[model samples]
Target: MDANDLRDLGWTSEGPDYRGSRFHVRYVAHIATHRQGGVANLVTDECRDTRYAERMLQEWARDALKHSGLSQAELARRLTAHLHRAIDRAAVNKMTLGKRAIAGDEMIAIEEITGFPAPLENADGLIKVPMLDSLVSAGNLSPREPVKPEDVDRYVAASGLPPGDWIALSVEGDSMDLVSPPGSVIFINRADTRLVEGGFYVVAIEGDHGTTYKRYRASPEHFAPYSTNRDHGPVIIDDAFRVVGRVYRTMLDIGPHASRRGK
Candidate 1:
C-alpha cells in the first residue's frame, strides 16, 4: 500500500487529529514519498463521485466476523502480529468512526485477517474504472512507483469483473508475461490485499525499488514469485515489502484472459 491507496480511499492528511502529531506526520511523509513526483489525484473526506456505495471499513469488519468468528480484540491482536506494532481494539473501533484517516498498511492488514472479500462495486452494470498512467513494473528489483498519473487520464470498461475498488495499471516487464504481458493493463482491487498462496498480486518494495506485478507463494519466511522470466526470483517478506493488492484481471492488447494460465 502507498499514497495512492490512501488517497483512493478518501484518506486526508490535513485533518485536525493529524495536526501537531509528529508520529502521524512521519508515517504520512514516509508513504507519501512512495510516489516519486505526481500530485495526489483528489484528497477529500468524501469520495469525488456518488456512484460508489461505501460499505464502511468498520461495517466490513463486522460482516467479516460472522465468518471468521474472531472478536475485535482477537482481530486486533492478529493485526498487531502481522504488522509488528501495537494496535488495540479501541484503535480498531475508533478507525471507522474517527477523524484520523486509516493508513494503507492497516487497510491491508484488516483485509488479510478477515478473509472477507471487500464490497463489490455497488452499481448496476458496465462500470468505467480509470486507467492509471503509471506502469507497475512486472519485475521485482526495478521498482517504479505505481502511483497514478493524474495529469492525464483514460478510462476502460469491462463487464463481469469481480469488483472491489478496481483500478488499472499498465504492465512494463516480462517477468509475468504469461499472464500480464508488457503493455497490458492489469485491473487490480486495492481492497483485496490478502496474500493467498499462488495468487497474483501487485507488490511493492519500500525504499529504492517501486512496485511489481507477480504471482505470490508464501513459505514461513519469504514471498516467492512465480515469474516467466527466470531472472526475477524470490523476495524475503519484511517491513520493506508489502502486497499492494491482488491482480484480478489483465487486458492484453492481444486479448483479455480471465483465468491464470501459468505459474
Candidate 2:
C-alpha cells in the first residue's frame, strides 16, 4: 500500500497505540520470532523498538508503492474503494512519515490494494484475541461506562486459547491479587458464564456499578475475594446479579511499566 489517506488509524503520542492496536506482549512475541527467524523470547524488554518497527513499515510501503506502479493518490483511491472509507493522498503520505500507526484492518486493506506480502502476517498462525482498553475494579465496585462486546482495546495473540467469546479486562485493585493482581489483564469467556464451584468469575449486582473479580465458593454460594489482604472480604451478593464472565487466563505484570495507550 502507498500509505496514508484513510486516517492515522493507530497514531498515539505515547507510542504506537491506536485502534486494533498491535502493541501488545503477544504482538511483540510474533515480531520477535519472525525477526529472529526462529523461536525468541517474547518478553525481553517488551521487544518494542518503535523506531525500528516504523522504519520497516515505511520502507515496505515505499517499495510496495514503487513496485505496484501506482501513484500515491491512485493507491489511496484504491484503498478507499477496498475499505469503503474516505482516504486521501495526504493520509497516505502521513503513513510514510513514520509519525503514525496503522490498525490491523487498515494494514489488511493496504496489503490487498498493493499486492505486497503482509509484513505482519500470522507466520506463527496465532489467534487474535480482542482486549479491553480499560480496567475493571478488583476491589470496590467502581462505576464505569458500559462497554459493548465488540469494543477491542487491542489484539493479543493466543496460541493456547481456543476461539470463543473471550474478552480481556485489566484489574485496578488488590482484592483479587492472589490470582489476578492489580494491573493484570484477565481473559474471560463471556459464553462460559455458568458458575463452577470455587471457580473465578466476574460479577455485578447492580447495572450502574463496575463488575467485581472474585472466586465463587459453593459452600454458601458467595463471591469471595482471593487476596491475602483481609480488608477485602467475601461478598454475599443478595441482589439479582449478572456473571459478566469467568476468567480463564491472566497476564501478570512482569516488568517496569509504561502508561497504556487507549481511550
Candidate 1 lDDT at 85 equals: 68
> Cα lDDT of all candidates, in order?
0.60, 0.65
lDDT of 1 by residue, 1-263 (tens): 44455658776665334433344555655445544332333433236443123335445656776667887788889977765567888877665444234454465556557777544343224455666656443223232344344521344555577757766777766777777667777787777888898888887866555676767776665555555788877666665776667888887654233122222
Give me the overall lDDT of model 2: 0.65
Worst 10 contiguous positions by lDDT, candidate 1:
254-263
| Tens digit per residue, CA lDDT, model 2, 1-263 | 11131135432243333234335665445544754655665444345655566777777777778878888899889877654467788878877775556555566567667787546743233344566655343212222333455455544544466655666777777898897767777887766779999899877666444567889998887889999898998888676777877888887645433123211
TM-score, cand. 1 vs. native: 0.43
Q: Which stretches of candidate 1 lie over 4 Å from their true place?
A: 1-124, 135-152, 255-263
